[model samples]
Target: AEVCYVGVTSSAPSSVARTPEQFTQKLDAFAQKRADVHGQPVSTHTIVSPDPIADLDDDLIKAIKEVGADLVVMPTHPPKNLDVIMPSHGGKVATHTNVSVFLVRPRDG
Candidate 1:
């Protein structure tokens, strides 16, 4: 499977502890580890945006297309009541993208 790992960083100062470079390095390391485990080639990409979570549908879609991914596997949590009022980023991506998307909720350790 063609795998593309994407990371987003914000320019504005906030409580985020990770720097943009650190975030990119983390993304690269994660992709490398996945590739090693799956024995498949992987690519890493980072997007610098003002809002990391919001307004990322377009960028995410573009990255998906650029990677020519057949399926998108995204980590997402169960929806809350507030999710009805404002959809999550994964929800927006599913709505906008044409490819198949699989949302995985992390398991408790």
Candidate 2:
């Protein structure tokens, strides 16, 4: 079983708009789904940082390393014009971190 650390960066306004509990629940559900599919127990640590793209890559890197993550997974919303390209921050973290990164595209209805 591998432990997972889910990091989310939100601006002040966004944070104010959403509750941490709500965010954590969503992440927990995600982790649980992965665990179910893998048939392995997985634990998750949800973090609400101010903004990894703006203020906290070093800290994020350290935390991810400390948690012994096998990979970092993030949701990316690419611009409509460049939907084929991954988000910039996804590239930045993938380039900067030692761990592998998986960028999941947002689901469309």
Candidate 3:
């Protein structure tokens, strides 16, 4: 059973209180729901980060390294402006990290 680390990073100002706690609460609710459906073997972790959510390639790489994760599976939302120089965050993470990244594009409804 592969362990999945679900990360939600917030770019909110540092003065905000209970931000991480709120994130944890949300994650706990989500995990509980999934656990109820999937039974005990469903392994998932919630990583609540206070740093900026976008373009934190180095931080992502470092964290995954600490956990000995060889692969990073992420979803790429369609970019609002296609002309932006840098690719998606997942793309940048691919080039910069010492790990492998798998990216999936969400289909528009």
- Tens digits of per-residue lDDT for model 2, 1-109: 5757465545343543376667777778888898888888877665566665555555566667778877887777756655356336667678778889888987787
What lDDT score is found at residue 38 in candidate 3?
A: 71
Query: lDDT-based ranking, best first?
Result: 1, 2, 3
Best by TM-score: 1
What lDDT would candidate 2 get against the real structure?
A: 0.68
lDDT of candidate model 1 versus the reference = 0.79
Across residues 11-107, which tens digit of lDDT does each residue of candidate 1 receive?
A: 6544543577777777888999999999998998887788866747777887887778788888888878999998877888888888888899988
lDDT of 1 at 1: 62
Q: Model 3 scores what on Cα lDDT?
A: 0.65
Please list the residue runs of candidate 1 whose C-alpha ends up more than 4 Å from where it truly belongs after superposition.
12-19
- Candidate 2: give the clashing pairs: none
TM-score, prediction 1:
0.79
Model 2 segments beyond 4 Å from truth? 1-5, 9-17, 75-87, 102-109
Model 3 alpha-carbon drift over 4 Å, by segment:
11-18, 40-51, 78-84
Superposed Cα RMSD, model 1 = 2.5
lDDT of 1 at 71: 86
Q: Residue by residue across 1-109, what tens digits does model 3's lDDT show?
A: 4445555556453343346666656666767777777775444444545565543665676667667777898888877687287677787778877789998888989
